[model samples]
Target chain A: MKLSDIFKKKNSGDVAKDRLKMVLVSDRSSCSPEIMDRIKNDIIEVLSKYAEIDQDGLDIKITEMETDDKGTKSVPALYANIPIRNMHHTAK
Target chain B: MGEVIVITSGKGGVGKTTTTANVGTGLSMLNKKVVLVDTDIGLRNLDVVLGLENRIVYNLVDIVEGNCKLKQAMIKNKDNDNLYLIAAAQQRDKTSVTPEQMKKLTQELKAEFDYVIIDCPAGIEQGFKNAIAGADRAIIVTTPEVSAVRDADRIIGLLEADEMKQTQLVVNRLRPDMVKRGDMMSADDVVDVLRVDLLGIVPDDEDVVVATNRGEPLVGDSKSLAGQAYMNVCRRITGEQVPFLDLEAKKGLFGTIASVFKKK
Candidate 1:
């Protein structure tokens, strides 16, 4: 009831919303947090061989893409964009 | 012709059958001819919940297999003259009846009744698919628990994928005391989390258990708040804009302040 209570409290509602957001995001994408982490590591591993990749800037996610189709496509495509600052120039 | 609405919840034991009985009974109380179909197959409970189990001779499977006529299989409720129920076959599983058969059965019922409410089983399996096959509208029921809400969100996504456009939610067994104590999710929090249009919210009531045990739908009892909530949902289904029940307001802001001060 008090204004001070609002700022200090992370109500169960807020906790529920935040948790649902995390889980639903993973559910919709069909990519579990574990799988995403693995994919992130694998991608960085492959990219490290060719260039000094930006591991900190690596982002991998799966989301719905608008295809000229009716339904929210069952298999949403994976979207991964890794930022590359510069390639390692070695013995070239 | 009538609208075939599916009363579904991806997770079990969240009062889907109870909601179906009350909502169907509620609609019938409003003078609408409503028939509830239990498509849960082997795990049949709607008929029992409606107190119509002893009356079912022919079930959904029989109707689909031509063993019984659609009219013959329908069991008219003893409580409401206009309300009816088509019991699911206890001997069969979800695989026995196909979605096409369900669609056909619903279509036939639609021609005869003002509303066809299908009681969908838990999980997004064959039974779930069959239940929603012919439904033009959906009412996804869920509790405030994290697991229930997660399943509800999945059901919403699946319904969207199935192109069942008019999907609404019914948040059941809401505890106001828990919400005020920051121990449970509020109705608004659930709405924002699931991203679905609100159908109704039923406050947590022990009377629901009593009503279920007695096979009497709470919707008929004017004394029950949950009954009032179901009647409101019925009004909404009939295209009347009924406002949601203020579940929180029952224990007003003053009560919260009093409780807060009592800590001293």
Candidate 2:
């Protein structure tokens, strides 16, 4: 059998095998989930100073979608979306 | 003319002494002039492992304190003519000898032997510093567990801080059955996480326990698989291309077949 085929058979259903994938991804991206959360919070605070953004509508989450490498497991992607509905509000 | 290599693990019972004993024995078997130094201070056991505990007249502290010469403290291994051991002082504390003292002692040993392997005491304390002080390289031994790996990481960081150029790893006590069942981490997994050059991987063989109980190093046992792994590590230290043992193939017919071409 081919090497890739053998690797596929060996890696299937083994969640622990994702350790190297997760660790390398985090290391290469230079951002862990905790760091991403902290950055998200900082962004929210900074944007809050200029405009009023709805915390409830602000969808800040990380989604790991595989870009390429069809057979191999991919890293979780970080996603962020902020909505400023009451931007014209004045501080009283 | 020889290199001083320190075998260390931050936590106790991770097989630092056993590795030292086996590697020393293996190197000696290869006819290399090897000297194993027990730097555990108050907790000496390398001499016992080498079955030379009774022959140690002068310990490390005595030699360092000028009670005896360095040559007087070195007890020759009866089994292997080229192997020598410097036993630790079970009564003296680690503070008895400073890192500078260890450096001086090992410097002298380096001029006499082909390899000087120091069995470092557990923890990243004074004993650890003294053990690795004059070494040209280091081998960090760790098990495939979170706590051991964490401690190994800390030790590696400390070794880097000390500016040691040659630092490799030896992951011991790996259970192949568990690793195959996805219950335990494999040697590759440990290596990937540590991101260090792997010297060798030793399986969790019961022969190791038998060897320890018999007060003999497994590395010299012709039939023991763990013994062979230690030998492979010794060869790798001297720049050999020995492959890592595939623990998963250590059972039944496949094991026998794999063993035929397996790295020594």
Candidate 3:
């Protein structure tokens, strides 16, 4: 931890807002953790046919993202970060 | 026909009953004929909050079961000539009243009163379902706390799923001092996170407890800040454009200066 962090605590209101933002994303999507797991497995199965994926480095979550440049509206978006090791060369 | 509005919060102890009592009383004070309905059933408290507990000869369950007429179950407010209350049955559970019954009851009440305000119980269960079954719109109440705001978000999703699209929010028990100190979320913060139109904000005041203890609504007090806030909410409900209370004004000179600087 930084020395300044020890002396200055984070504002609790900001903390609450941050927490609610993350929590509401999944809540608004109505996607349970189990459903998310199933979705991740399905995506991995599809992607594995095309590339060698680093499964251990995969991360996926539902979050809110701005839909416009003005930031006036936001919508729940699914974000997935998957590490690729190699691509499969297929011949028909 | 009158409008049916349900006052609800998914979590308990966020002042759903108090808001119902005060808003109902405030609407009646505006010369609108209003009736408050407590749909909590077994754990009912709206009647007590309105100070009409002793006058309840019948209740919602009794009326639905045909044991009493709708008029027999409605207890008039002691102070307001236009206000009345339909108390929930203390002995019955949430399952005792079905959504169909509540819808019919609200329809009948709508024909008679200018406003029928329902005090919905906490939790997204049968009680919540029954409360919003017949309502034309909803007023969701939440505090600045994380738990309350979280529950309010969940309720908004549920309400939207049910196609009850006309929903407004009221942030209750807001401590402006804490917000100024950056320790508590402001009403604007909550509205931003919840993504709903803000109806009003009620400051945390001791007068609320005093008024509740006396079996009187704070809106009748006239001197209380929370009472004035609730009155403004009632006026807004009637399509009146009212400015929100300047909560920072209640702070001393030092706070006013701090707020001014913060705005810049």
lDDT of 3: 0.91
Candidate 3 lDDT, B44-146, residue by residue in tens: 9998888888888999999999998888888888967899999999998999999999999999999999999999999999999999999999999999988
iRMSD of all candidate structures: 1.5, 4.6, 0.7
TM-score per prediction, in order, is 0.83, 0.77, 0.84
Docking class of 3: medium
Tens-place lDDT per residue, model 2, A1-92, is 69778666764324344554554445545678698778888988998887888888887755457767772344667778998866645653
Give the residue spans of candidate 1 off by over 4 A. A1-9, A38-92, B253-264
Q: Which candidate ranks first by DockQ, i.e. highest?
A: 3
Q: Arrange candidates by DockQ, descending.
A: 3, 1, 2
Candidate 1 chain B: worst 10 consecutive residues by lDDT? B247-256
* Candidate with more favorable, higher TM-score: 1 or 3: 3
Alpha carbon lDDT at B136, candidate 1: 97
lDDT against the true structure, per candidate, is: 0.88, 0.84, 0.91
Assess each model's interface with DockQ, reporting 2 decimals per model. 0.52, 0.12, 0.71
Which candidate ranks first by lDDT, i.e. highest? 3
Looking at model 3, residue B136 earns an lDDT score of 97
What lDDT score is found at residue B70 in candidate 1?
81
Model 2 / residue B198 / CA error / Å? 0.4
